[model samples]
Target: MNNKLHGPLFLAILSTLMAFASLSTDIYLPAMPIMANELQGDIELTVTGFLIGFALAQLVWGPISDTLGRRLPLFIGMVMFIIGSVGCALSTDIQQMVFWRVFQAFGACTGPMLARAMIRDSYTRTRAAQMLSTLLFIMAIAPIIGPLAGGQIIRVTSWHAIFWLLVVIGGLMFFSLFALPETLLPENRVKISLANVFRNYSMLLCNREFMRYTLCLTFFYVAAYAFMTGSPFVYISFYGVDPQYYGWLFALNILGVMAMSLVNRRLVLRYPLENLLKVAVTVATIATLTLALVVKLQLGGIVAVVVTIFLFFSMNGVIAATSTTAALDAVPSSLAGSASALIGSLQYGSGIISSLFLALFRDGTPWTMSWIMVIFTLSSITVLLRRGPLPENRSSLN
Candidate 1:
């Protein structure tokens, strides 16, 4: 292994490319209220559109990245993102903004899927998990800083400036990605055939263990999405907190995730990925259940709810990083990108479904979010633990 090729600098660059999606999503959240007023539409509708666009775009970009090489697709996605940002900045109507948002999200999906594929391209399961955790430690900055930045931007100028900022970030990411070496070697590249693509997907679909592990991560994401979608309402509408304060609350969860990611990076070398996942899922389930109990009992106030959700989300970083490594390792290197695509499609698919459900159940109360989190977390735990324990090294089994 070349030290220069896999050093922290490369990881940091890769993480930034991957975190672009999160930044695009979260950075715009603080502006949602403003966007609604400016566009003369309901705030909830605008937010839901953004979530749907981002989630659905993942399904398209993931397979495209797998079929085409990672680089070209990434470059194209960046260009599209930049265009979308400009369109958003210039939009005067809600319909036009929604269209641009969908366009923007089409480009945002490339980072996470390809970043994971690149890790599988280079490292073994445990090392891949560690590398993912390291990348996440860098990626965590998007959620922590995106809202704060958006708030400041909104305070100084209009929400349009936020879109312009994304335009700059997208352009920078486009050039920076050129420096990343292609990790999917020609010998390991899958043929871009419809038949082969379907065959590969069928094979993955038939694997019970793969589905179980992937769903575990997906369910956790459902909880996360529920929090993202529902929390603003809970904090601002129900509890009467300011939007800036909500950004700080969101940043607290990001901090928890970053802390757990650091812990995962350190422990992955010493422990089996499966054992770590088991522990993480167990902790997350317990935390979610505890939160549900607190909400049910009306224990404290908004503070207790925030603390519990933060703890639940903290375990997600570890579970997601490990499960992704394990799932990608199940396939041959030739199919790494496709495998990553499927994992992402499933994860965000769950997110889309959960977000919609939360929206439907939303009543400007914290209980709705808490109950949904508990249900998904418990279901995930049941599925993951039902198959005995996860294998020590998933790649060896493959």
Candidate 2:
């Protein structure tokens, strides 16, 4: 069944599955202020709650997928996602919205977590990096479209319509899986047990190469997630940009992502992915530092902030794809699901921290956002540099 699937269709399915997280998170962002006002609660809690659920649920899904094969767990997850979206649509207050968002994430996390494992199931290390970059290139369109659609929906109807739209997306994906072949073979299945789950996860944590690569990407992602959480306030609230036009500025960053992912597809053929990862992180750190300074000094107002933020985000094209590919490559094939989950868990976990920072430092300015981005990008670079050199040839865990 897997053999019969065409490449482009297969990529589209996986990309949409992975893009589910972004689509879920970004679509309601344009309505944050209005939602907060009407619901009499902070809308940011919904994002934090979703991240918390998204982070922890991946641990359960990853190992379950390894045991049960990919398709069954995904079917279960999509149903949960659809139900959660409906719950969100019907929520009467921010607390209810947050609760349902968390529930929605329980199902949504399965998409990207399994998507990475599925990619690993099909490709070798270098090929996986290239394929993931291409997948990201396609998936990047979600953020570009999400907020635009959200803003329009709000203008005509209510923020509740956004969740209704997500319900439709979840339903389509649930049906789409019928065509997706189960990638995990019977021969590759591991027995489900508490002891085995702990052992496999322990082995991954003890692998220095895996941890280094994982943390490098994870820290860099803190910056990106920070941008996602903070940008609406910075652009629309602080700078007084109209809510409808907010999507245009947001689209600029995603266009940079698409451009860099396109460049990465070509560059991977000529350069080692590890080297590319290092260079991308360094460039991202520099851009973030400049952004911090620009916002602190009020250097060029919103133009400087947007340009620098665009440059910083563009590096995600290379950093995210290569780092995941390299980290999963450090482990055995059977651990791919668990490895993907741990990577995702750590990445989304940082969002909780980002949300907290914004809340604690709620200054009605971009200061907190800019600094958080800089600090995390620097942390990623520090992790990458302090690790020193790697062996030209390394052994994977047995």
Candidate 3:
């Protein structure tokens, strides 16, 4: 592998790498209904199992990248990803698919965390934030087209094709890994120590500012996963929308996300990230609360729910980038890999929690999804308002 890649190529590679996580989730969603019907198991658990693997793998990949360097972990992850995808494609039952999805997710989550970690490796705080906004903007293409593509594939073929497509994607990623530079410098490497990983997390926990933003970011992911978990059922089962069109709806929301991200990228040139964050969260909270109410009252029906969902999702464009940059700003650059890992773990951890809530409480209503979004967004807002700005310092790692 090259010790360094040209800048444009690096960004492209990193964005695709990170985007794979969302790709893993969104691409398979359209298959959920048919898969559940065919395999005679809970559709919800299949998604949940994948998410659990995706979320938890950060714990291992992030720290290992810190010790072993970025490229090796990514290569390992890609291999595992292909194996998992193949397993999913060949699955005979929901249980087997769920287990394989976990393996797949274990491989998938590494991309985004490593992408962020690598950004920290190559740039300063503010610049890294800008780069992240750009990366996420490009990354949107995966989720944007994923379900739509999945829907089309399912229409033309079967759900099994989706995993086979994933297998191809993972294979391509594996081969492309050869071109990516090892962004982790030797001086920056942490000694391979379980104790060191444990200690790094403790340090993150103690940082008040980081924790505040961390909570905010995690809640945002919770809201997203909640939406993702419930939407197929709500749209297809409850509203009678065609499964073929689910991707179109999801893509429309992502367009809003892209627009907001572009707006933030331009706005960040003139305004502070904190100021923008406040406005974004405020808008999201209001939109989500209203969504919950509309769901409860059953007032405007599916159209209303869809509009409100879009409003809530649009805010994530700002929330994800700003909140991530804000949280990472508090820690030393040296611990970027570990910090990125911790953030990914917490984000997915929140997703798992949110998904579980949907499984337990949802009764084929969009209300469960709406309420969870409201709860997570409001909680995020409260933290920002109450916690205030944190004092920056080097990590306890040194």
Candidate 4:
């Protein structure tokens, strides 16, 4: 049962599935202000609703994927995504839109969480990192094009049209999954029992290395969510940049991720995953602190801000792939699905908290945003330093 499909084809399918999750969030970002105006509600509240919906749904989907197997949950998730997109398109009120967005996120979680687990099931640590880098390289195109596409869609049609576009993408992905072979073996599958669920979760929770990497990854997401929630306000309201211009800024930052991911893919073969993660964390800490200082001093304009963010997000491309490979490597075969669930929950759970903090401290100032990123980056570095380095070989974990 050599389940390893052609590398390029596997990557293509994985990237498409993963990109659907992100496209659902980011493609509509440029339209947030528009959605607020149309729905007759505060933009912040509407945005918060979407984030909340997305984060909360992760808990349910992960356990389901672990119990039921990857393919079915993924199919159900895609269907839910399509339905949510349709619901969003038909929504007439903010509350209605919020409900549908929650529905949407529930579906979106299937790909990112399960996809990582699937990669791990098929490949070793170094190879998993390589595959993820390639998958991320393709998935990176989503953020680059999503906002731009959404912007153009908004420019030409109503915001509802964006949801319609999501519906179409979801449909395509659903059809594509029909050809995607199940990567998780039956011998490895866990039955959906409450006691078994808690037992597996306890195993993950008690592992020092798993906790360390999960926290490290979570903090990184916190930093990202902070910037994402604040950047539009900072760029548009304070700097007087038009919303459409944000597409280019967003695209440029993603390009930075793409560049770093390619470099990491090459470097992972020579340098250890742990070493790469350490370097990435260190660079990210410095970049984030620099961003904070620049904002405090009011040094430069949008270019400075964008460049700093680009550098910050570039680190994410490396750290995310590294931490994922590390976490998945730590899991025993029997608990791989549970391990995947816990990691996904931690990452999105941290995002939920970070988004809350961003909302609370939002004074419409760049300083507030920078401070949040600084806090998250420093926290992640602190966790990694305490844990020391990751084990060099996956075979040792077994």
Taking all chains together, the TM-score of candidate 3 against the true structure is: 0.95
lDDT of 1: 0.78
The candidate maximizing TM-score is 2
- The CA root-mean-square deviation of candidate 2, after full C-alpha superposition on the true structure, stands at 2.0
lDDT of 1 by residue, 1-398 (tens): 54555677679778997687678878877777678678986555544565566666665555555666678878887898899899989999988887887778777777787888888877877778888998888899999899888877877789999899999998988888878777766555666674556567778878787777888888888887777767777876778877776789889999999999999998988887778888998898888888888888988788888888888888867988988887776667767776777787777656666667765877667888888888888887877787755555644411
Q: Which ranges of candidate 3 are over 4 A from the true structure?
A: 1-6, 192-194, 390-398
| Model 1 CA deviation exceeding 4 Å by range | 42-60, 192-195, 392-398
After TM-score superposition, the amount by which residue 86's alpha carbon in candidate 3 deviates from its true location, in angstroms, is 0.6
By TM-score, rank the candidates, best first: 2, 3, 4, 1
Q: lDDT of candidate 4?
A: 0.80
List the pairs of residues colliding in candidate 2.
none
* Full candidate order by lDDT, most accurate first: 2, 3, 4, 1
Worst 10 residues of 4 by lDDT: 389-398
Q: How far does residue 132 in candidate 4 sit from its true spot (Å)?
A: 1.0
The lDDT for every candidate, in the order shown, is 0.78, 0.88, 0.84, 0.80
TM-score between candidate 1 and the true structure: 0.93
